[model samples]
Target: MSSSGLVQIDGLSPIRKEDRKTSKVMLLFPPEWVPTAPYLALPALTSVLREAGHTVVQRDINIEMYDHFFTMEFLIWVKGRLGMQLKPLQDKEKAGRLTEQEAAQKAVLEEAYAVDVFDLAQRSEDAKLIVRGERFYDAEKLERALNTFREAMQYISAAYYPASLVFYPMESNLGYRPGVSKEVFACLDDEQVNVYRDICNQLVLPSVSKEKPTVIGISIGTQMQLMAGLTFCKMIKESFPDIHVVVGGNVVTRLQEEWAKHERFFTEVFDAAILYEGEHALLWYIEAVNGQRPMESVPNLMYHASGAVQQSKEVYTEKTAALPLPDFEGLPLDHYFVPERIIPYLATRGCYWGRCTFCDHGQGYFDQYRGMTAQHVVEQVTALRDKYQCRHFLFSDESYPPALFKKVSQLLVDRNVGIKWTTLIRFEETLQDQAVWDLAAKAGCCTLYYGMESANERVLNLMDKHAKKSVIQNNLHQAAKAGIWNHVMAFYGFPGETRDEALETRQFVIENQPVIHSVELFYFVAYRHTPMVRNPDKFGITIHKQEEYDLPLDYYYTLNEPVGISCLDAMQLCEEFYKNDFSPWAVRVNSREHVFLYISKFGTNKLPQIYAATKDGATTAEGVSGLVTWPMAIGEGDEGKEGMSRVVSHGVG
Candidate 1:
């Protein structure tokens, strides 16, 4: 074994021509651009490999693809395309084929013409510089730049392809929405919608080739990334036929049975699939791949054997305290879309509650909740802060373990890590304590995203969320009292939920608007592996059509019979309710990027004040207490349209 404890082996005396020999390996995060903030999976795996004394290279191709696509040169190309493809608003006959979204892009194109192309280009450049921290943050300038960036993406998608690439997440038509094998393969085979293939080929493949790794590991964390992950696997197998390919992530962990039954998928795309947490799995698998042992010995692995699929004993569970600080060896931290870099760390894995019926977050091997010691957490942060010269951080745990977080919060003060962070947590009774909230705030807790799924007690019970509506209200009150921004994630349309219950959720948001700074409302999605899906009858839901399109495995169900409201009805209800005021909508929080700018100018406690001044133009020191303004989206009709505004119920100082 090597000094770092990684197993090492010698090649055969003469190394057979067929036995490709190299210890180098590359870990990849495939694209489907979401937040430019680093995802935690690759870094976690990288830490494992490096601690085991292996040569590992990690890359975030998702952010890289965005950086490559959003360039001045590409903007020039988009400008030229817009000149030809966009029709005047008066050309009704020619514009008839345009969808609502496309027509909106046409309006953006027309607006672009009002300003000189060169001037628009200058603004675009300034936005890039501002995003990269080259210019000062002006609220108006930031708003204008974001609008210009959005329009640029809209123009490209509308004129050239069928995709949505914007400031937030990137969406493409080739998503693995149809979880079945056939639909996924069809989308992968279609080059028109699969623009990521070209992106991988032009930008990623060259870099991978240069690394010359013997094995390629791809993380497929969400259904959105399935196609891109498979595309990379297919490309690598075709180009470097001798290279070994491995796939794993949250999505892979859930679809083990689906992959096993459809063995041909793995045969054609990857060599093996890591079942659960990958730290130990990758370490053992790499040793086996190095010819030190046989593949059958690797735990929690699914691979092909003699024309049939085979699985190894499932026995790898990571001890969080044992994990080394993640090594971001080859990742381009500076290239992420934001000016200030935010490092992602998972302080724990699996949900502590582990029983939300609408969630599959704790199914199968993921049910066991675990967390690192508070000391370890602080040490990891300090090391990362020193190494990256970045003090911004985010905990990517399923739900940041509350008890662990409280301990770490105290440690942060003693150690003085000097970092600002955000994390997701449940609205449990433990956090209602002001002492806990104060510890978090003193440690620089900027935001806490609570799973305030619903305000209706019945809906909460049906979903097995186990959180009482009143308790949630108190938790938000305490969090806000600590001066931390409280963001609530809500959802309606759970099985058997009535319209009255849905309305109650909205009313709850309005009543607690003082405590809750932002709200993200989503309709319920019945995941296939959830307890509710397993016993749909209990929830009075019937699975009518499991497969909606040729997409990855997403659920489609209807209440067995209407219980006061249907899914469609619930959706419309929420939409109409929030139509006039969007402040409660999470869209206004701006935490993804602008929140950092806000804090830099105004102290953490004064975020609401800056928000009021910028968003509402309030003259008083207290700022506006009722309505907030949003820059009108292109083609949104009028300047002060109700649909284009967000309203905050309380003033912040």
Candidate 2:
């Protein structure tokens, strides 16, 4: 019977047909958020569900959908559809060079982000300049991000969530995305809608026969989709009224604090909405609906049944330490777009240093921090390697707990998990020790994402990111010495940022070129749930009155600082840096404008944007550093957003 029926997928293997004979459940990944891939989300949900003894199935609509979109024939058609925008990418070698006609258009697109018009730090007062007209958008670069992403998808092959994909589908937050191009919009949208409809049909009507699911648990993952959640619930109800539809995820919790009382506002949609984590709430509700319980008293569940919506009490305030690891046994690990199975994990919840003004890291009403024991960490990886037979894992932490990491990493080395992993890490107390590094690398952690924001101290003081440049630099250096591939995340356009500081940032990149993977940029955007959302008026940051959307929305307003520049001015600076102004430029002195060239490459899908990791006189290397920059754009007449953390290089220029 070794290959006969199904297998139980606990921490290592999920519950497959071999293990369960009665029930079936499917975890649906709505499209658009490539960043929040299904690999990260599925494990968390499934682990908890399995803990409750339920059989689970995962349907990654994004991958299945993309397979239907980007084909070998389609890339060329998309490039042609994008026309001028894609001309630069056809030949990677000629990325930066432009024809006069193309140059003129590029100039216009580059200039669109040239003026810091929001008046942060009074730059607009000193210089009356505002980027306008054709200069308002970087159509070509935007096109590059899209087409490259379309092309990159051929390479990345990630499992994505459709909720946001159905809505904003583009990675608009960071430098990682294909810039938003208007030309690709029409064709992509048509394809996206077509894909969504197709998948929904597949869900309702699989080609072969299967039992109707006992319950449908729809996740409202992002807060931006409150209305979409309503509409989605209504649609599901209309389609699958025979089955119970239970709603969950962080989105519902946030809504409860604001609009759960407005049940009349969302009638025929959600049968029950869990405000907090879905573990216990889901188990009780499922059984109650199964007629096993006479009357349901499920904690943290909301329902608009019997004509009125009823609210429930909070479940667990603190996260449990002995968390069940994601069961990946029957799940499609190979389906993800990675070199190998990068099994992503979570070590903790809520950032340790949570005082940053603009960030909502510690905003979950129950934002209590809980990390797993080192023993548990080792056990899970050991089990995964024993069962799934994989070597790579990725940690999906906002900022993974350093202590937990220290112990867990050490334990992995001792236990010989025989796996390698990567994580999103922070500076400060975490990066100070050497044991953590030695243990981490040996334990299979080969990469670290360090958010090093700025090289300037004044900026650091303003941002309140206690991460000192010296400490980060040394840690990044040491990590490299230990043979860890490091990624440093940085940013531009703060409240008090000067072209001089930007130059210094580029200089830092040049100096520290050897011990990094690549420099990344994050435009400061005010996130919801933080203190900034509490009083944007006090901060001069006009808050965005959020509107209902089918996807994620930037609700917090972001402009420039108080003294010299406007938000638009800072935005202009960002545009320039994004276009021509390059970081890690000092290393490749000859290729100083490679960033601009890289932009063109993306536009043309010709050359790859090169990152400088190590420097050799005239050349720069490639990799990541530990640079993390918080935003300063709140709004004009604003004090600016949180200047959290931005790490720069020490000696390149």
Candidate 3:
């Protein structure tokens, strides 16, 4: 080992900086993310790595897993696996020693066995064709295709009993809680319930073997992907002991401190982890591996060295303008569920308005805000548009700053980029101008998702989101008038918010239904890194922490004086709103990508065909009780509707 504690190969010799060896890299995007578009992380990191003379292959394993799940070959394999599981369970039951869990597994296996895998496989294959071709424009056929995917997921879920895997809003669970590190580690090695192990064996291992990459990086952006990402990492490490494995992304950044404490993760799972902005850090890490520099010189890195986990002394943030345009050359763009490819673009590094007490998205960045100029954004976006032959774009920024939003809108119109796009934004008084909305629409702004946490002025101010009610209403009205679909995201129970204040938010959404195209209502969560959680007493709430949940990102809480809505009250209110008042927002096509395509095709947000059909087969504009569609129906748990698409707006400012 070198003095910096990096492992060195026997035969390879260290080269000078000017003659740096080309590192072979395999970048994997793990499962449980939306399969509509390629995530920006892989491409973003790939561009930087390739720019530094590295050979990089980026794989969207999430989309690939979904694609493989719908194939006849995979479905038949799942049937065999299920049968093998059922055989052992049957023997145990016949011997009169079956446990309740085993019996339940047997039941699931039997039901799945009865599912005629041949017929389902054919339908599933047909579903793939429907989504990729012009047939996707037909709403009925599209809905059937989506249902076919869900059915395939159910069939696959049976092989891993107790694991509920779904297609679009990726709410898969492996019967193991992710917040508990013990459960996470146990789930990694679980043969029966961890579907990702099979996924890693079938999909990931083959690619790694063929490429023989010296370094592999897995991006775990959300909690949903943590298990799968780690599964791939652990499997890759075990199978190819020589290849270096590293994990990064927003979720990894949030859990860096927790990971430092878990030496096993560093020693057994991955060789290292890149935190915060990973472009420069990963490049330097690859250099360290190649022996061009010491490992200790790589910024934002945490690695096991000399019997301990050592973090780099320095931190680095990307200069937004200096970065190259994201390269999507190797991704399977045609295989996404949508017919036309929607490229994800990021114009900013972090949120400009980073004062929301309930938000922890800012934790993902070291330097809170670093953005590209309007001209730079337009240049890169247009370049990507022409290169990919894709017209639809998803601006994947935490929140587009108002000045940049206005300037980019003007530039796109003046430059005639002609690409339909959508992004997450905060309702601001600066965006109240009708002319600005018109310009944005003319520049191909198909949709705008707003994080309108609450319409009650007091609650909004308390959340540190001082958006005025009038300004929010005006922004919605103007955006709607400009033919842009407005998706309003609000929640109940922010610390001391009273029942009437929560109702005021509901009333605002109901009263503004004409302008509010769609809605996602949720209950409050005191994320571990949020301002409220960091200083709970100041917010008049007490956070409850349990020792078992060592890797928790959020916590359960209670109001100190009970003067406001309790956690249960917020959840119940959310459930009641969806039960009684979600009809207007409930659409036949619930995916944001699907809605974006519809709006782009029809040139308007008033998509009557996309709304939920009445019993008589006609679409209705009036509110109807108990009429819920694919994802608008809130679940019974705290993981209420996170939105239609995870890629579009999960952690938006």
Best candidate, TM-score: 3
Task: Score candidate 3 by TM-score against the native.
Answer: 0.93
Predicted candidate 3 versus true structure: per-residue lDDT over 1-653, tens digit per residue: 33334332211233455887898999999998777888888898999889878999999999999999999999999999988989989999999999998888899899999999999999999999998889988877887888888889998999988889988666788989999999999999999889999999999999999999989999887788899999999999999999999998878888888998899999889999988778878888898898778898787789999999988756677778988999999999999989999998888876788787887777777666788999999999999999999999998777789999999999999998899999888898898889999999999999988888888999888988899999999999999999999988878888889999999999999999989988888788888878888899899999999999999878888889968999899889998887778777777575788889989998998877677677987544344211123223211111112222253542210
- Misplaced by over 4 Å in model 1 are 1-22, 75-123, 134-136, 158-160, 175-180, 364-367, 545-552, 583-593, 605-653
Cα displacement (Å) at residue 640, model 3 = 17
For each of the candidates, give the backbone clash count: 8, 101, 0
For candidate 2, give the lDDT: 0.47
Candidate 2 clashes: the total is 101
TM-score, model 1 to reference: 0.82
**Full ranking by TM-score:** 3, 1, 2
Position 221, candidate 3: lDDT? 78
Instruction: Give one digit per residue, the lDDT tens place, for model 1 in 1-653.
Output: 32323232221122343553337779888876354477777888888777666688888888777665566675565566556655544375385766676667567656654545565566666666766674435555554555666655564554434445444433355534446678677766666457667777877789888989988899876656788899898888888888899998766876776787887777888999987677778777887888866888777688888998888754466777777887776788887656687777766666677777766655324337777788888888898999989888866666677788899999999888878887777788777789999889889887776667789888788767778887898888888888887766676677788888988988898888778776556566666667777889988988655433423334677888767577677667656655544543333224343564455335554453334343455322121222122221110100011011011100000
lDDT of 2 by residue, 332-381 (tens): 55544322444555556655555555555343335455566778767776
Deviating ranges (above 4 Å) for candidate 2: 1-24, 35-38, 68-169, 172-195, 203-209, 220-235, 257-268, 292-296, 317-319, 433-436, 493-507, 537-540, 544-553, 556-561, 583-653
